[model samples]
Target: MAAGLEARGRTATQVRLRRRFLRFVRVRPGERVLEVGCGTGVVVRDLVGLVGRRGEVVGVDASRLMLGKARTLCRESARRTRLTLRVADGARLPFAAGRFDAALAITVILHVIDPMLVVREMARVTRPGGRVGLQDQDFGVVAVTHPERELTDRILHGVAAHIYPEPHSGRRLPGLLRAAGLEGVRLQTDVFQDTTLEPWTKTFLERRGERAVRFGIVDAATARRWLDGFTHLVAQGAFVLTINYYGAVGTKSR
Candidate 1:
């Protein structure tokens, strides 16, 4: 599995976006929240604050490396006492029925083999009348200002398939939610734009490009070309990349 996008400085953006995403769900204090694939605990920290000190936040991921980072981040937070980090698969969550008030699976289903199974598990673990939420980017909706949009999409999607199967999984979220037997399932979309390309290019190269090269997905030269193209697009004020993230929330029937 590929290392999560959350690295040292990159967490700030994720934290900000997650806060906004969670706002849609109206997360409350003192709730038992389960975060599936809580990479590096960035979302976990945000959830801890939202749920307050009286709440419990349990973060689960299949990657121990991610869990290690999450554990470390949890320990450094003010609500550390309210947090728990564990390693578990989304398809088979290791918890009793109706164990949580809410469950969130962020940017993780696309990487899993069977997103429906994960959604079922999320619904199963959530208590009656509780919420089960999922957030994921629609790869088909990703738009870039580059001239080679098709090529870029192909390469990017190819990389995703190699690194994480089912890269464009958000398109199926609604159907999956229904299959999971949840009620009142709703889907909302959000867009994020980069104001400047320099920072975006630098961050992408440093984080994603480096990982691509390390994983032998792309050669260093190819990575450099990708960065250069991004830089050019940014210089022309045409460096616009929009990702339509689909978020679904539903209630578990009693």
Candidate 2:
């Protein structure tokens, strides 16, 4: 996993988002759940708790670094016994058919090159009538609080295009789920609107900004420019960054 992603594992928003996403999942005790792209086991820890002693939570990620981190976290959890972590790819899950009651891929579908394959894989692993849930943010729906909307959009798109070649995957999730032969697909959106930019600015500058530098994605100059623009927007007191995250759940055919 990228160092930036490791850093993201420790962010407050990331933690909160993971918890909220789990709540959205409504995992019950004694149920088997697979969490795709379970980076750093942040969500996996929550899943373990939700599943209780009788249930099991299997977490899979393609990144060895992330799996290492997840293993460390899992080891520290008291509920570790109920959790399992694997280094696997979402596009090709290494599980037998109908192995899980439900599956969730939080903020991971966007990274997949062939999202349909992932959807099919998740459906294949889940039992009939089982639910498969996917959650991701749409860049087009993201509300920027920065003063320079144009610049922010430009930077965001530029970086996203480079980091994630297919940034449009999130937009196609609903259709992909339908195409995967899942039924009763339902899509819902959640918005996190904050008037103060301090949290987000700090999140970006401290974590994302540093990651950009570490990964050589953006130079110090560009990072500084982005931060400066964000600071100015925060000072204006009219800053409100609204994140539009959508979640869709479908049941495999019986």
Q: How badly does each model clash, as a count of residue pairs?
A: 0, 0
Q: Best-fitting candidate, measured by TM-score?
A: 1
Give the TM-score (vs. native) of candidate 2. 0.85
For model 2 the local lDDT of residue 118 reads: 86
Instruction: Estimate, for each residue in 1-254, the C-alpha lDDT of model 2 and write its tens digit.
Output: 44455555565666676667667666788999999998887678778878888998899999988888788878856354467789999989999999999999987887778788888999999999988989887766666766666756656665566666456565667788899999998877776566666444356544555556666667888777777776777787866777677778888999
Q: For candidate 2, list the clashing residue pairs, or say none.
A: none
43: Cα error in model 2, Å: 0.9
User: Against the hidden reference, what TM-scores do the models get?
Assistant: 0.86, 0.85
Q: Write the per-residue lDDT of candidate 1 for residues 11-82, one digit (tens) a residue.
A: 454555666779877799899999998878767887888898788899999999888876766786744447
Candidate 2 lDDT: 0.76
